[model samples]
Target: MKLQAIFVGLVIVALSLFFLSPKVNSLPVGANVTSNTSSNWSAAIPSRTDAGGTITTMVLDAQSQDDGWKGYVGNISGKFTLDDASGYSIYDWSFTVTEGEVYISRAASPSWSTAICANTTIISNEQNYFGMTAAEYDIINKTFNETIHQSFRVGVVDIVNSSCSSAFTYVNDSKYPYINESTPFQEVLLQTGTDLIYAALLETDNEGFHTGYTYDFQAIVPDNRTNGVTTTYYFWAELGT
Candidate 1:
């Protein structure tokens, strides 16, 4: 897989949390639920959605992310509401990410493109970095020059239930955990010993240094360039319960 040398700061947010490894598990017979780097093929849900729960603060756990700046740290935080006969708030929701993905698609309801994933698969710098090892990050950083602003336009991976599948729209899938939606998404690489996180970005202590960004969940996603701008990438997660 070819990668561009462009740099992007860390970014994370709570859109539709949950991801990484693809696996299906048995549940105790109930409705589906939601969850998030939780990327290590592990389905353990450390947190869940509460009544009108909102993760306003975001703090990057330095211990988990000891690699330092490679991607932009962002908070895609939001609440889930049911569209039943009596619009109500969800409760006691469990979180799970079966064979899935979190897409960084176009802003508006746009056509899915393979190139968008490549554009967003960036070489995150001090401003941002994620889901990669420090050594791997250093190699990429050393290889690509900061001034070399270019585009890879490689395309998307062939994941089972990802945006790559033209017919696999989350809004139409009954198994999708969080409040279903119609959005584009974003994928990845080698390195088994490495801490390749595609799940949720664990938050750390505010300790005063990190303010406003102290969110419940966070992750370093691709700064897509399909449209020649990073602002166009939209965060969408697919969950299973």
Candidate 2:
């Protein structure tokens, strides 16, 4: 029995290793591609793998019966470095950042090509002062800096970090990309939905500006207030010089 079992295992391994074609006809059963961004997976699992040969969408964990009215506030920074096996910074490897992107999202990797977040301050899609449940408005009006959001649906992106001496934004806004311009203090009405959301990470640097920056950017995310379930927003970044 042992000999037979061993032979079967070898055959299975051999088939998995060498018998399959270089390209798979379809993703193996139960293949869980966790990325739900609008763009299809590149190089690995193209749309042809699906039966329809069309782009497949992996929708997020949509939730209802809960208030979409919670807030996150934070600063984001990045380090572009090459590390040795021991993780020591290899300074000679050369690293510089011309710009950086920060994403406040419920998805681990939001799409760079798609502006999944639906809020923007450019032209008011939502009015901050209204379009809220009385409960939500009352709660925010009572606690958060209502002055930041003002009575506007969307505010200008006027983030500043010129030097260690200038005022910088403490948080980021959940807004659309593409048409977004880099500024700080872009405020919009509290968006309502359980769909996965993300925001453009505005750059705040000490490039001739006031500065006390630990990180390169700041952002915020809205979440569901379901009891016993703490919302988890993923923060992702990319840097280039």
In order, candidate lDDTs are 0.29, 0.35
Q: Relative to the unseen true structure, what is the C-alpha lDDT of residue 185 in candidate 2, on a scale of 0 to 100?
A: 34
lDDT computed for candidate 1: 0.29
Candidate that would win on TM-score: 2
**Reference-based TM-score, model 2:** 0.33
Report the Cα RMSD per candidate.
Answer: 25.9, 24.5
After superposition, which runs of candidate 1 have C-alpha atoms over 4 Å from their true positions? 1-82, 85-87, 90-92, 96-100, 110-158, 161-232
Residue by residue across 1-241, what tens digits does model 1's lDDT show?
1233235444476688445645423211111224322322233446645657565565644324323222323333232333333655445354433223333322333232322312223334311432344555433333222221111111132222222212111112132233212221112211112222232212221111133323323223343223343333344443332
TM-score (all chains, Cα) for each model: 0.23, 0.33
Candidate 1 Cα deviation (angstroms), residue 117: 8.8
Which candidate number would show the highest lDDT if scored against the true structure?
Answer: 2
